[model samples]
Target: MAGLVDALGPILELMTWVGFVPGVPLLVWGLIIARRRCVWTRTTGEVYSAGGFTGFRWTDQDNVQRQTLVDADVARGLVAGNEVELHYDLCHPARWALGRPKHDNTVLILGWILTSVGILCTVGGFVLLLF
Candidate 1:
């Protein structure tokens, strides 16, 4: 069998660009959302389910209705009409998050680290090819 690096070289190189391109924005948004959430106002929102999917609905400060899928397991006993504390985006109140998503953050941070290392490897690989 080929060496592990040789087998995975192309994948690692491509993933570097892919993760770096999207991961940067996702990481930034995750961080910004996390920081803003620190001061999110407590609002009474209804958690609803239909067709095997669950989501939350609430009205923002501007009185605009908003809805988002709830993926964070930080809260429990989520049923219809279960009042929950939600965090809204300061810039866009319609955007919301139930609570801190550790898994998501860990993935974002890991993607960044891996992408950074991949970029270095790609540069070295290119240099080796040229030489």
Candidate 2:
């Protein structure tokens, strides 16, 4: 019916904008988390499964053994007792280094732009509905 269609128009537009805006921040956050530097030893280690996830465990020169989860890329071609450098976050030791992830500010900027557009669309939708 024409009445139903008219009412749904603004709702659908608002929904589309709302859904699109958060994606920017989500993408940026994912990239930031992925690109953040981590620390690791210069020794290659074997892949071990723990807590339902694959990780690596190695012994440091001090004879201290350390274990951390690595990304799939690092997991491939990895062998036990092989030398590898582990990258880890200085603040968070729990997180292990995989490899250097690319860093770009474009994602962050896109997030901001999407957020602004979403806000504008939402406000406009509300104003239209009120009238």
Candidate 3:
């Protein structure tokens, strides 16, 4: 029984580490997506559609000219010289672009999942060390 417990301890520790490894990136990305600001603006140029994507230029806050692109679904109804709001990560202004519509529940879901996994792994690792 002692040998069995010892063997199981290492396996559980590995599993816990594997499970928690993704939590950091997931949490960071989730926060980045969550805190992004969306601003409404009118397209200043023609929207070109190609290869299932669309692109156009627009003015953002600070009156600076910027370009944006969106996938098929959001692009379908957009037209040249049309008004649209862009969701962009403030921390990565150069990557200004469109993103999916905000889902209130997604943040909570990701936060909980990542936190749980990270905690579980850290706890499991400690438990293994003790065993």
- Tens-digit lDDT string for candidate 1 (69-90): 7664643468777878777765
* Best model per lDDT: 1
What lDDT would candidate 2 get against the real structure?
0.62
Candidate 3's residue-wise lDDT over 36-88, tens digit each?
74443322345666565677665555667766666667677887566555554
- Give me the displacement of residue 84 in model 1, in angstroms: 0.8
C-alpha TM-score for every candidate: 0.41, 0.33, 0.40
lDDT at position 82, candidate 1 = 82
Best-to-worst ranking by lDDT:
1, 2, 3
Model 1, residue 74: what's the lDDT? 40
- Full-model lDDT for every candidate: 0.66, 0.62, 0.61
List ranges where model 2 is wrong by over 4 Å. 1-54, 58-65, 69-74, 104-107, 111-131
